[model samples]
Structure formats: C-alpha cells, structure tokens
Target: KEPKEQGDAKEQGNDDNSTEEPVTAISEDNVKDQSIPSPTPPTPPPQ
Candidate 1:
C-alpha cells in the first residue's frame, strides 16, 4: 500500500512539472514577438 501511494504521488508531481515547459515557452515567444521598438514621438511643429 505504501509503495502504491508513493507511485501515485510521483506521477502527480511529474504531471505538474510537464506543463511548465510549454507555458514558459509560450510566454517567452510572446515577449519576443513584441520586441519592436515603440513608435517615435510625434515631431513637434517647427519652432
């Protein structure tokens, strides 16, 4: 019984870890995709 319980706990831990990589990858891609520089400030009217 103890061994079965341990196995179940380990399986659940692995499942939690498995989802982290994809989420991290997606967030990183989103940041990279928005790397464009902000638009230049509008030029002031000629003095």
Candidate 2:
C-alpha cells in the first residue's frame, strides 16, 4: 500500500462563469434591438 501526502488537500475553486456573462449580454442586446421600433419602412414612395 502507498502512503498519501500530507499537503495534498488543496482548495479546488472551479467556477466556470467566463462565457455566461457575454452570452447574457448578447441576449439582452438582441432583445433590446427587437423591442425598439424602426422608423424607416421597407419601401418609400416619392411625393
């Protein structure tokens, strides 16, 4: 049997939230873009 090391109990902080913020920001931008109305129409006729 092998003996374990004494200083092997280190804290493992594995928080993977790097991509979440950017994705949420992009989603909010898209929703805001759709929420706002466009002043120009598809086709305009000359008077």
Candidate 3:
C-alpha cells in the first residue's frame, strides 16, 4: 500500500508540474527530500 501510494503521488506530481510552476518547484524539493528514485522529466536549470 505504501509503495502504491507513493507511485500515485509521484505521477500526480509529474502531472502537476505541467499546469503549476509553483507546485513543480515544491514537488521537485519534495522529490529530493524524499529521495524519490523515479525518473522525472528533465527540468531546465533555474536561472
């Protein structure tokens, strides 16, 4: 159940990144903090 939940959350984050830049930033930080291993689409370097 935990793994399934995490997988769904990760996919949700990936999808959210498209419609919400703020959410994408937060999601990226969460991903790093959680040490999520899923491959995410390349995010351009922050300026």
Q: Which candidate leads in TM-score?
A: 1
Candidate 2 ranges beyond 4 A from true positions = 1-15, 38-47
Q: Top lDDT: which candidate number? A: 1
lDDT of 3 at 9: 94
Worst 10 residues of 3 by lDDT: 38-47
Candidate 3: tens digits of C-alpha lDDT, residues 1-46: 8999999999998878776987778988997966644433333333
- Give each prediction's root-mean-square deviation over alpha carbons: 5.6, 7.4, 16.4
Model 2 poorest 10 in a row by lDDT: 6-15
Instruction: Predict model 2's lDDT versus the native.
Output: 0.53
Q: What is model 1's C-alpha RMSD?
A: 5.6
lDDT per residue (tens digit) for residues 1-47 in model 1: 99999999999999889899889999998877666322222333332
Pairs that clash in candidate 3? none
Worst 10 residues of 1 by lDDT: 38-47
- Candidate that beats the other on lDDT, 2 or 3, i.e. the better one: 3
Could you tally the backbone clashes for each prediction? 0, 0, 0
The TM-score of predicted model 2 comes to 0.42
